[model samples]
Target chain A: MPDDTTPLGAPLTTPDGFVALYRREAELVLRFCTRRVLDAETGVDLCAETFAQAFRSRRSFRGATQAEARAWLLTIARRQVARYLKRGALDRRAREALGIVTPVLQEGEAEEIERLAGLAPLRAALAEELARLGGDQREALRLRVVEEQPYPEVARSLGVTEATARARVSRGLRTLAASLELRWEGERP
Target chain B: MRILDELEREIERVAHAAGEARPRRRWWRSGALLVLAPLLAGTVAVAATTGILSGEPVSSDPHAPRDPNAGIGVNAGPGKLLAVRAADPAGGPEWGLRLVKTSRGLGCLQVGRVVDGRLGRLGQDGAFGNDGKFHELGPEILETSSECQQPDGAGNVFFAMTSIGQPASADPASCAVRPRGEDKRPACPRGSLRDVFYGLLGPEAAAITYREGGKTVRQAVERPAGAYLVVRATDPDRRDVGWWSPSVTPSWVESIEFRDGTVCRPDERPRRHGRHECPLKGYVKPRLDIATRAELATPITVRVGTAREKPYPEMDRKSLERMEWQRRVTISFRARRAADARSFYKLTAEIPGRPPNCGVGLGSPIARDIAAGETVTETLWVAHRCSGTMTIRIGYEQQTAPSQMPFHGDGPPNAKVGTARVRIP
Candidate 1:
């Protein structure tokens, strides 16, 4: 492990540490915040605020591991996103202030590939079918797929046991597969 | 499948762009010292002690201390403390300091400026700095300015330097106290809420306290709401009570009685220490946070309840209206600190009146006192009914400065209900 004490002599300056920290984690933080909130520009701005806060409270770090640092910073990002919600995104000023500009959902080549590969069609059919499942099963799929978090992490974060998490994912996936098969057959000539 | 991949890639791309585009160096001068110096030293020291003078093979610095600061230099005297400019025009009462922890053991700094405003600490690890709009850290950052301006930042920013001397302690009791009189009276409800309302709303001086019983004996409890209601202890006879008032509404509420068996009550009296009135016991209030449905809700509807394959069968609006349905919805809330008491809050739907077809089949009680920086979520159930616009109303009552619940034109004679509209299937 790198010497944790190194930051002690690091300029202890806001801009310097901010630049370093941002370079290291801004992308992940931005992507995470973007997924949580609406727009990318706002995500950028939130990224700035997250670092600015990290800069201000530099004293809170206890020389933990790099992974721990990432978690700490990400945790802060989470709170900021939550605050955005509290202030009510529906309000015009807040929306503007937070840079919550919703970017147009443009179509791209990757989407075309999935469509051609049949995975896209399968997933859609699966999703539609998945909706036919219970809330727990659906939630399992959404958390695992959309959030892209591991089942264990998702379950822990959502306050459920790992087994329950697996069950939700299992049940959801099964329903999707069944639904996709049925839909595909119905569409076949 | 393709759309998800594309979305993920786009997200990653933008995130990467942002990471690359960020300023390569720290903006604030003081923050640089604590975060960067160590890394540089480790490299230099490793190079020097290795005696690579004779073109020796570079070896990992085995002696490098576990912590980089182990061999780093320290400022001869008090370090250069970063100063922030106080909000101009006082940021219009919506401004305060934003503290982020970059290094451990950073001393607490005081806020300074002649805004004639209040200061409190943000109780939670709130996020900040997205396009200048920062996250809410709750109201705990409102402590006294530890030091005045260091002849820099134009005194807008306060600093903490041993050389300069400790920042003067502004009585937290006074600083946290809301200027509104009627609102503050509830903790020590000696005067009528009406009297304090008019007296404090204006420029006149007043204070209030809103305190709840502590979960434990040792942990000092914070007041319950935002700046609206604070807890303070004061003499019963003295008219020291003042309510924490929000800019929006100014009606005093003592307790909230929900449909379930939950009640949230704020202290009604102020406690005093010597001549200065200290904040009441349950003075620390929890900052409110709301997560919108669309923020977390998905357009696709899923089946709920039942063990069958079609627990949440897709039903057109008409079909949903036709069926006898039990709709379940989940809502989550977080607080910066412990609340005054169990909030008997009500959730209101935007749809006016009970629609002929829509009705709340069941509702759960959220009576737990939320601690600061904690997130809590609960699910609520309602029956689907064929009706015009279907909505649910959620409100809470507490003896804080005043209530944030909405006033239904159809509330009880003396009831105030805050409404949060939800879509009914």
Candidate 2:
């Protein structure tokens, strides 16, 4: 921890601060990587790659607080996720170069990630939030977010213009984002 | 199972190696990164911090109030921060904002945030650095703060903002994160954690409402202070954030609902209270093809100079529609009269766009003392938002005093000896 007079955030210039950041945010990045691509093993690779990339460009980080750090990390992680989705597989260049190990998911680890991601309870809250939105919004969210379809496809499916489809999905997602505020502590059932 | 442990060691190795490779730079601050960060993430943090920076109006310490943290109000006689940290409408579980009241006659606004709260980081660095959330990390540990410089004590707005930043301390990557092997990783939520505007509305204020993202937003102030407005995004987060280059546009306030209510426009609490002319029906921001020329009263002449783009990183703008807007501009003044001696001269650009009251008004004028008949070129940035036959009229004046020797000093020289215009198509 920096002294009271020292700047607010972890300097990340030192090894300890950088590692502290990883120890702090690795799991969230793991979940982000795993849930987005829906694979535990790939999530592991992404987690490693994300940290490696972060370490490489640690100086590029300017946030003095952990919030800014995480936001910065998430941007990198999101790009990592985006890249993974864009390509068929994770780009292991960063991880491989760093000689980081990608752990195999134990038998139940995959299910654990699903649970950690809180997809079930999240679905419940989402359903509630979705139910509250207009039908057009809900369907638009379903096609764009759930199905992960492009705006054009969503628009065609909704028999609306692409712009209208984007509006619905955007509105739906925003309303649904409120669900993020909720803690998914429910059971597997 | 041991993924993070190894990664932790690896992180140490790399961070150490990289830290050694490049000595830590003292110049870099979180604000720079926040400016570079995505609109939602960086701007939200910045906007909140900026609100806080709009320091309270009162300057000159309040005659050593018995308790600085005592409950303060409008008539409290040069009051200070109240010893209160309630869950304001604008605040979350962590973030806090305080109005920069009149202290030493300087309105000091200090905005605070937990994670990406750049302003919060300032407090952390200042007297209130690292209260908590440093040792522990998860998705984020939020702590809100403020930093504001009121324009001649005009903008007396108060706001406390919040955002979900890093994760909790527990490493959810660990399979055994919870009792049932359940991992709760509060990863960065999809879609940026938007901003919430909350703070003490003045005692005299009633309610506030304004326009945001093509929608009219209203926030009614039931109490004297502590009313907030949560501005949520109306658009869906781009699913593929792998690569996105956004063209920033200057956001403006249309009309404000005041006098009837205590609240100010959502953009922020204003220095002046009155209905504004805004939200022009079917308003579309215009883009100007800026053309340049040098109309000067020589021994100074600008050659074929270049215009380089400067990143516009203003702190407030949650309402700006995502459009291709010129964020900042650095116009270069080049003149090589085959030098004799380099002297100092100032350059100023003025524009009167076709339609007035459009984009942001004239940016700060550039003041450079160029020695004529010298092979010299100087580049300075100016921020402007008028979109019509935009004219950049350059004029210069000689300076004798040392105070005006620096880049920004206003003396005489108010004639358009030369003019350059920009076109909006």
Candidate 3:
């Protein structure tokens, strides 16, 4: 991180900083991209593209804390994922010519980690429950839990207040838990 | 126990991964694109300009004159330059105004460069009366501020007396540059000095005039009301250059003082608490004319609406019905070709209100050109209690037309044009 005196300097060294950021937050970024793209390799590519963009624009980094940095990084990742959706694979070739690769999150390691954390079973049920909810509610839950952003920051990104952000997440969690209960009964119970 | 042990193992593994990812290099090279961007941009701009200059044809300036229209004895240099005190005053709070006498008796008044409040000049004779007079108009001592002079006094500096019959007060002690010279018109010293404190402050001043029976009086008035003098300079070629002060209501001016040797000063400052003569009625009517000649088949538009076409009836029926009343409104035309000559067209709208009328003045009426295959728009008002249908009879007369059919012609009068009536219900 830059010392207190330097207003213009980056918060941290470029390459190491981005790699550390990837290692710390890669799985969350992967899940975010997967939720939208529905393919493993595409998700990995999007995640990498997000990091590559973040690295190039490091001059604009303005994070006060690690949590803030994670929020900013996720915002960048979301933009990269949106561009990927807009242009598709043909755009990938154009982006490559521009020296931009839409990096993908490797599926195996992220899946294995989620399984070990006991979140693997929840993923499909959560996605279904989230899709059923209103747009704002689903966005709040994804940003707070899956992306691991703080409540106030998510509220700001969604143009809402902290209390509203927290309330949406809580309501989404309850609805999700009820949906999972029904799914479990329909399957193995 | 097995599940708990698995959770602990997973947490440990995650910790190990995160610790290993900690950065080893404190410094990393930034992307390659940034380093050579300036050099690449410079090369491109130079090449593009070179290409443009090598191939493009040189052309004369379109606005350049075919014939020189230079004025005799007029040098290309700044005329009648004033320093326009770009800095704020040093210490005092009193606002001031300054003016230079013109060859004509009335001079151009510059207000609001020195102080806060504003005052105005009598524009014409009898504007105040047959004999111009000033009265203690608005309220007294609205606010007080420090009046300052320049440490290195450069220009003519003066202060506003509180009223026509009051002692001129000095600005407060806190004002940085105190007036050190004699009370008479003081000269500001040259070069930088702290007597006026630090740098330039504000750019505002005021000039106020008042009449105290048997004497013409003037003062440099200032107010903390933070008033302004907005000067709009109009450059009408060499023939004319004029300035107009933004119109302000009389109630806004708070103080008045006469200059030295004017019969309107007292040893003591007086309270401002009286009314002055109200602005007079009737406006100065401007004279105008319309010129026409033999031309093409196209019709030209003229504004019959003149300054005399006041909304508040310019003439009563007794006065207007007997005399042929005419007014000239200003209009502009574009010349398409030298051969395609044009002439002025005249139109007037007549309507009757109460005989003795008082209303806001008439607005300017616009004119239009009649292009072939294009419709012309004209405005008309209905005269009351007479004809329910309004008929606008447009007529034209050419100086070159023969005695036969002097005013009217069958097919768009060659060397003459005449009017046609369009009925409005």
The local distance difference test score of model 2 is 0.41
> Worst lDDT window (10 residues) for model 1 chain A?
A91-100
Number of the top lDDT candidate: 2
Q: Please report how far candidate 2 places residue A69 from its true position, in Å.
A: 5.6
Candidate No. with top DockQ: 2
Off by over 4 Å in 1: A1-12, A37-45, A55-65, A84-189, B1-425
The model with the greatest TM-score is 2
Note the DockQ of each predicted structure. Answer: 0.01, 0.11, 0.01
Instruction: Give the alpha carbon lDDT tens digit for every residue of B159-225 in model 3.
Output: 2111110111111111111122221222212211111111111123233333334554433433222
Task: Compose the digit string of candidate 1's lDDT tens values, residues B1-425.
Answer: 32233323323322332222211121212354346445533432111232211111111223232231111111123322222222322122222232321111122232222122223221111101111111122222312222211111111111212111101111122121222322221121222111111111111112222223532211111111111222122333432222222212122334322223333332332211101121222222433333333222222222233211212354334333333444445555443333322223333332332223322222222334445555545554333332333343334433222222111111211222323444443
- In the range A59-171, model 2's lDDT, one tens digit per residue, is 44545567667777887887787666533456654553443434455577677766666556555666677788888888887787668788899999999999888788767
| TM-score of the second chain in candidate 3 | 0.20
**lDDT minimum window of 10 residues, candidate 3 chain A:** A90-99
Cα error, residue B76 of model 2, in Å, equals 62
Over 4 Å off, model 3: A1-10, A35-39, A81-119, A126-189, B1-425
Task: Using TM-score as the measure, name the better of candidate 2 and candidate 3.
Answer: 2
Per-residue lDDT of model 1, residues A36-85, tens digit only: 44444455445545654554444344333455566667876776665554
Model 2: lDDT of residue B325: 33
